[model samples]
Target: MDMYTFPFDTQTCTLTLKSSGYSDKELIFADVNNQQSLTTESQQNQTMGEWELLNINASTTQPSNLVFSQHCITYQITIRRKPMLYIINLIFPVFCFLVLDVASFFMNASESEKLGLKVTLLLSISVLLLILNDKLPSTASQMPLIGKST
Candidate 1:
């Protein structure tokens, strides 16, 4: 087939393939470039390719260093919601707070020990938050997420 075009746009010409699978299914992104033994999965799903033109995110102008003879950009795309980072940052601390809240029950009707326990737990969780912050890298070193010491 002839992919004839005068001005090529990388962002426009390139097609994006997105697929969703069960948690167990291995989501793999394969770049079908050059001559190589086609993967068994590809061979099986040959008729069910997952390439799609970036119609919604179409490019306004032609991209630079355009290259042809290439198509079918496959990516294991997974739908995710925002607030993931915020939730993560708060999950541990929030969990600790919840635990402390329950611990408040240990306090008497009106006593110093009860107040002390609550303060102590809050301080402990404060330290934990700092540790978590330090553990997470400032920049994204790898995909998915940065490795946590745990």
Candidate 2:
């Protein structure tokens, strides 16, 4: 499951553990037999991409006796994005190329010089796009906001 926000934001994901053919009555939950301890172990050891763990909350839910269900323990993990370095290192160069392109438009050059400048800018932007395409999230439904803006 991809938990990506379109515009460079952080998100939290909840993971639940439910067993088959097990209920609160059959599988008693106590200080010794509980999921809270497991949750702590998971949070301490688990690592997700580029996101830093902010907090983890774990809780148990006892289902009604009427329906056959397993005891559920929900683990909510909050993560924050670490995108500042990438923006400066990868995206800043693209912005510079864009500015150069815009400046080329205002330059009073000969037809050949202008054509050469346009070609160079196009090639530079194309190379930047190719580099960025690999770094960006391909599974996203829409293009990245930065790419769209530029």
Candidate 3:
């Protein structure tokens, strides 16, 4: 759940299947032909909204304890976000605004016009920051790199 990496981040989620009432002797969990439980169709349906499935690893485990042991099938699913959405919606616009601000300095406008242009650009950037603020959680432990850059 680290958002510090933001658009470049990859998340690994674990899905464990186990029966609480059933022990390993009563119920066993095994992958077909010792292969991953994920089907070909699931692999093909990799893209889930903004996330792109990267890898899936499945394993069976039997926890050793004084009590009855239960069979668990764990799947580690790795997915990376499709950064295009963030790039287009957030980063690109900010970059363009920065470029415009910098280029405004070279414009052959009067001092008053330049000041007004700078003020306008500053307001535009403030509005953009406000929009970004709404998208990110205020309770985050650390600010995201995107936020810092913006």
Candidate 4:
């Protein structure tokens, strides 16, 4: 899984097939590329809300039968979300505030007014950070890149 996109990511997962009751002598997969030997697809229950299939590939591996050697299939999948509202609500205002803060540097405000502007911006940014703290995954192994940039 490419989790760098966290909450919005795609993944390639593998499914391994093996015979538990019989070893390679009794039960062995034929040509791994043969679709009939592996799995089948049903059109009725195809897609899910968060994920969709992109492609799939099948392959065979060398038998190393301590317990059971396995055949494997790889699935390529894409993740989907409805993030328009999230971007508009959480990102737009902060972007506007940052732009305004940059513009304020060139304005001809007095020293006291300029200091007040900076302070106001700082407070707003702090509030945004606090709010974002709750929205982000606390158990994430590392800080999110978006949070680092912010």
**Candidate 4, residue 134: how far the Cα is off, in Å:** 3.0
Off by over 4 Å in 1: 1-93, 137-150
> Which pairs, if any, clash in model 4?
none
Residue lDDT tens for model 1, 36-139: 23333344544422232222222122224434222223332221223345456756567768887897897686787887887888788778778777744354
lDDT of 3 by residue, 1-150 (tens): 767888888889999998999877888676644334364546686655878777777888778873988877888888888888778878898899999899997988755788888989999989988887776446556777876745
Q: What Cα-based lDDT does every candidate model obtain?
A: 0.44, 0.69, 0.78, 0.61
Residue pairs with colliding backbones in model 1 are none
Better of 1 and 4 by TM-score: 4
lDDT (C-alpha) at residue 135 in model 1 = 46
- Candidate 1 is scored at a TM of 0.33
Q: With candidate 2 superimposed using the best TM-score fit, by how many Å does residue 143's alpha carbon deviate from the native? A: 5.0
Arranged by TM-score, best first: 3, 2, 4, 1
Runs in model 2 deviating more than 4 A are: 1-7, 24-49, 65-69, 141-144
Worst 10 residues of 3 by lDDT: 32-41
Steric clash pairs (candidate 2): none
* Backbone clashes in model 3, listed as residue pairs: none
TM-score versus the correct structure, for each prediction: 0.33, 0.71, 0.80, 0.51
Q: Model 4 off-target regions past 4 Å?
A: 1-9, 15-76, 80-86, 137-150
